[model samples]
Target: MEVVVSQTAFNRIRCCVFDAYGTLFDVHSAVGVYREELGDRADQVSQLWRTKQLEYTWLRSLMKKHADFWKVTREALEYAFTVAGVTNPELFEKLMEAYLKLECYPDVRATLLTLKEKNFKTAILSNGSPMMLDSAVKNSQLYSLLDAILSVENVGVFKPHPSVYRLAEKEFDLYPNQILFLSSNAWDVCGAAAYGLKVAWVNRFQQPPENLPFQADVEIQSLNELPELLNIK
Candidate 1:
């Protein structure tokens, strides 16, 4: 909703790290892929499943009991189905597989190429497990443009964990101030900002931040405006 960084600050960023899932790929709308599978209850089932999946991730991380994203995704699906009173295990598996085949956001590939042409190092810092991210990246064919696809799996944690933010900075050997971390999840943007990296909150839904004490350097509705914010042109 507000711009916190100056043109000078944006220009200093040498690498642009992004959050996967909702940031680059439309993970939340994965329900559309399962709508036909669910028949009449399609929309409700899909929404419930996605909501529970993210809740499970946060709960599991807080308990310090780790399950990779895929495992948690399945567990959440099962819980959601049980809550929704659905009985088909076959349909559940089919829906989860659809996640493996998620399409990138319309502006993603073009934006990545634009950043690359500007000579900025680009990578993904995700809560996704190594195999989960690898499968998604490989399947989407966007891995070629990425310099690194770092995940929290190596640290057995999730985003908002300061350590995960540090891991990305270390991997690129860039100063925290030199990296511009972008995420659609407000908490993740807050975390990266707290960790001292310049941050951009991709408020794709035009929602407010989660009332966090920290703020993003810039907040844009989509990646389409990112190059302009960073003065890439």
Candidate 2:
């Protein structure tokens, strides 16, 4: 399906903000490094690790107890290890290191470059800590293509939170409708939409639409379609 931005909303977009993990980077990639060690359980471990990591973020946000993404990530990894019955300390360290350099999705660099060439302000809005984001972006060679790398470290909360969504408006000095927020996470898309941003849900995994109060203005299967969706050409 084509992007569905209305003319009015389309003209209001001054900046494009993206969620880092799962959207741009392959969060499951870390497990690929130890495919042999994980055997048949690699996928399970990755899924559980990611699920718990996000769960911790939401739980902490609601409880008003915030921790950086790194801590939450490590804690989630430990839980995944226990649940999956993987018990190598060395493998744990390796997995954490791999996460620092997660592979960027194939279409990310070209899409971001297209946006940059079009002079659209592009930024990363993520739950990653500053250090984590720095390493991932630099490692993926995406640092120069972006205008900003925003982290929840500044806000002490994870996504689906209105405050996290507000960081884009605060950083760019633009209203929510003037920013186009993209995320692979449906709940995040809902949160940004609810907060008044023009949103595009990058349904990379072909997941079902979320049953939330707000919905994204557009949905696409990959970043390759983004520039066209925004009429960047």
Quote the positional error of residue 90 for candidate 1 in Å. Answer: 1.2
Model-by-model lDDT, in order? 0.85, 0.91
Error of 2 at 61 (Å): 0.9
Model 1 misses residue 87 by how many Å? Answer: 1.2
TM-score of 2: 0.96
Total clashing pairs for each candidate: 0, 0
**lDDT (0-100) at residue 135 of candidate 2?**
96
Instruction: Please give the distance, in angstroms, between residue 152's alpha carbon in candidate 1 and its true position after superposition.
Output: 0.4
Best by lDDT: 2
Model 2 residue 114 CA deviation in Å: 0.9
- In model 1, the clashing pairs are none
What is candidate 1's lDDT per residue for 108-154, written digit by digit as tens?
Answer: 99889899998999999998888878878887788878999998887
- Flag regions of model 2 displaced more than 4 Å: 1-8
How well does candidate 1 match the true structure in TM-score terms?
A: 0.95
